[model samples]
Target: MANGTGEPAEYEIYAIRYGTNETRLRGRNFILDARPDDPLTMDFFCWFLRCGDRVIVVDTGMNPVKAKKHGHTMLLDPVATLRDFGVEPERVETVLITHMHYDHTGHLDAFPNARFHMQAEEMAYVTGPWMGRRWFRHAYEVDEICRMVQLLHEGRVDLHGRDRAIADGVSVHWVGGHCAGQEIVRVRTARGWVVLASDALHYYEEYERGIPFAVAFNVSDMIAAHDRIRELADSDDHVVPAHDPRVAAIYPSAGVGFEGRVHRVDLPPRLP
Candidate 1:
């Protein structure tokens, strides 16, 4: 997928918001300044990447049943949303699992033919002894983890040790912090390299203000991951935060009627 210039072909990256949690946490997302009165809410998103003939999917959004169980409002079926965007979920060959969080891995079954790419350490972290503790297990669903194990046996799982390129212009980097094996995806786009900081940096403010998210396996690693995200992206604008509503406002809409629900990150932003 190289261009005439020998660089990997630039891809189109889209961030699709499928759900939101309106329950205000009041400054719970950021550490070090627990403002109990400052309300905080987060949007749930899954990213899509397209390059010529190849299509790659980032985290799969949570299913409606699970969303309701967890107090999140599922806006739309992510698979259906992809179909609306002209991507057939069944035809997608590569699915990137940033981490094992329930929201990110819930729809794995939606892409039956895709090989799931995940950090090797992440799989170990989630299935290892740490999960025995309720705090660690609370964020994950046992059935999903078990299904991944089943997929591994079926030869549908691809695990990587660290930073690895999944495609011509797409790569995943292990920045273990939010979780022991949390990763961020980077892809070359028309606007340059865009880094999808999935959960590694949930909000733009988390990276800009040097504040770690409240739930982190390693605070020092989270801080280092922030640096890595900046280094990988062309600029701050090229770094897409996972849960920030501002992403929808900053990027151009994918199409008319898709405003706020689907934003095109690969294209130049509509707002400065």
Candidate 2:
């Protein structure tokens, strides 16, 4: 599967639904919930992009163990889920961390050889004073955040301050608001362009209405990021919302509940 760059030449995207739950904040005030399940438990999963000879995981879903302690549920087993997709954890050489949020970076330890890609500002936010205080406390896990910081100190993480291309057709853009240095990963799939919105815009509504996520460091920056995502996508359909349920339907669904089978990212029919 190795290509010219010694990475997987062909690209495939898989959508793994690791968890799902209803969020009152995301719907009633966040966006349009015209579907039967108004304020539906949108798809909460990670994305996998296989390019050339490399396998890249966009974000890791929530920690099921920590989730249960908090009275929440998870849909996939982080370890088994990727294995089912034929992706060996140790084989994942590149892991692009979208942000420092609990859901996005929980399973960092899973990718043994992964060279994590993240924004410098994101690292700054997670390690700064605002992390433990009220305004920015609830969204992150203290220990995990600290662990990521340690990883950075140990040189296991590759922090990117601005948008940079990790590989050909795969680039990381600094899109904030969801978190200080939150970013979106874009890959040139065989079909066309695919941008993993990793919380830059939680759902399509944010982009549609120009509203930022409730848990944001800077509302104005979030709004600007939304515009940036739209512009990068070129077309509305070209962009993919991180937590949107539509993503589950639009990308090929893989893996059993918790078995890690969601890496088939081929485009699916749009929801009408």
Candidate 3:
């Protein structure tokens, strides 16, 4: 879609790999038993969305402290990775946080000029009584949640309900399986609509193989999210899962010096 002046309402999306853990067994990733003995690469990433002169970031990546604690090796600091893309954190005006998980909510203070958009249910879920249970609060970092609270009081956080249009061709939808307020981003691109399936489907096989991720809050919601992801993308390849290393192999690199680290998700995937 384009305005009368003829500028297309399409955004360029990038999945920037910042951290990765290759020690996990496939059984640990899937809920049921699917190739229980196979090894898997679980990459950590924060997405970048740009349309014309407008820029929007998705997920902030993990704090270094959390990265070490989880045994996830840090390839590059996420903020620095954005700088590599020529996007200064200070100038970023909009950040769409996929959820309040430790991996997605770090360095809220990094983008001082940006308003963090999150699902209201997520903000509430992190602060609510259910957090008292260890099972419900395992992946959250207390410091990050506290920082979010501080930002909330400072009026720098924008919380949405179920679905919200971010820009001309960008939107976010709450899936609520991996976490109470888990969300996925959908952006219109030159190839077509693309869905950023943040934690809803960590690997393509999780969706394609009809198996949900293991760390789910609700299995039913997780299964239903697969349908939502399919509905939002133009094709199967258009849906980009949050933690798959196959992403880099499927799409071309973002640019020079970023090969294997960052890849453009807005472009059509390469054929096998």
Whole-model Cα lDDT of every candidate shown, in order: 0.89, 0.73, 0.88
Clashing pairs in 1: none
Candidate 3, pairs of clashing residues? none
lDDT score, candidate 3: 0.88
Residue by residue across 1-272, what tens digits does model 3's lDDT show? 34335875888998888889989788888766747889988998888888766789999988898889988898878898888878899999999999888999877888998998999999899999979999889989988999988988999999988999887788899999998999999999988999999899899988887777889888889989999998998889888988998898888899898898899989988978
Please, what are the lDDT tens digits per residue for candidate 2 over residues 1-272?
34676754546777676776665344433534344235545557678887545788887777886776654568778667778768898988888888877887778888877788889998888778876777686778888888887888878899876889887778889977767888887777666677778788777767887776667787788889877777676467667776776666555545445333353555643557
Per-residue error at 249 for model 3, in Å?
Answer: 1.0
Per-structure clash totals for the candidates: 0, 21, 0
On the 0 to 100 scale, the lDDT of residue 266 in model 1 is 91
Task: Give the TM-score of each candidate.
Answer: 0.96, 0.86, 0.96
With candidate 3 superimposed using the best TM-score fit, by how many Å does residue 142's alpha carbon deviate from the native? 0.9
Off by over 4 Å in 2: 5-10, 23-38, 254-263
Rate residue 185 of model 3 by lDDT.
Answer: 94
Which candidate order results from sorting by lDDT in descending order?
A: 1, 3, 2
